[model samples]
Target: MHVDVKELKGHPGAQRTLSRTVEAPSGLGTVLVGIAEHSDLDLDLRVESVHEGVLLTGTASAEVTGQCGRCLDPIGYPLTVDVMQLYTWTPEANQTDGDDEETREVTAELTLELEPVLRDLLVSALPFQPVCRADCPGLCSQCGFRMEDDPGHAHEQLDPRWAALASLADTLNHDDEDDDASS
Candidate 1:
């Protein structure tokens, strides 16, 4: 979504309420991280002229699909999130002593693009490690089987001394699962 900054840029204290459906740019599928690209998003926002710049506050939503991070099963879901952002005029609106790249500015055309903002928030809101359910057993490392499909999935108990080599594989799998969870 792009808002005309002229509507509020110089008109300090001005306000406008907008409700629009905006298409996420093509190839947004890559930006989704784990979810499917959303062709469009529903946005309900209030643009207010603030001393600093244009303050946009509201909510955005989209339907998305992803796979459970563990079992790799298809997961269809909807994502809804609240977003608040300030788009400022360059240089003059650069109130911070921070890096120039850190400031979000309005375009020379006096337009504020909201695509990046929505994409960032939506991607971050999605589960880093999504699951079909909280208690999903995921897949068995031994036979590449869906554990939930067969909750009793397991290998036969082997002799302890000889089992060390076999159990070592499970240990490695546990470590991998841990690493994935941390990320």
Candidate 2:
């Protein structure tokens, strides 16, 4: 949303409030493939300017839908972020000292780019690993089975190399048990 800071610049203590719904973009870096399903985003931003270019503070709220990292099931979460920023207007290059302008004219008319900022905020808030449910039985490593769907599916250990390691581990466990018994 574009805000006109012209009035605020003139009045040092002036402040303004704004509200709008913005649609944010989605891509590889913007939103993760598995996490964010849709590119469209809905956000509510409330902005207030204080002390000229010194500070701008506001709050933003949004809702996003994505897929769980583990089960790939759809998930939705609400997001709210507090925003604070500083603005500096570019000075005119060609103006000379002989013009006798006492005070530099500052304008508050500026467009705040919210997409990149919003994307970063949302992505940072997401969990590294998302589960569909609290007690989600994830996919079995052995036979590619969905543990949640079939709890009865027996995991067959087919790797003979692992079997040798398993036997050695069992032997070590027995040795420990024997030592404890002797003690």
- Top TM-score: which candidate number? 1
lDDT of each: 0.76, 0.55
TM-score of each candidate? Answer: 0.76, 0.61
lDDT of 1 by residue, 1-183 (tens): 678868687788899998998766543333223434446678899988887778889998887766777788877777888988877776666766364544468888888888788778777787767777898888888888988788887988577888888788999999999999999
Tens digits of lDDT, candidate 2, 125-156: 66667666688776767766777798877866
lDDT of 1: 0.76
Looking at model 2, report the run of 10 residues with the lowest lDDT sum. 28-37
Runs of candidate 1 with Cα error greater than 4 angstroms are 26-35, 95-103, 157-183
lDDT of 2 at 59: 62
Clashes, model 2: 2
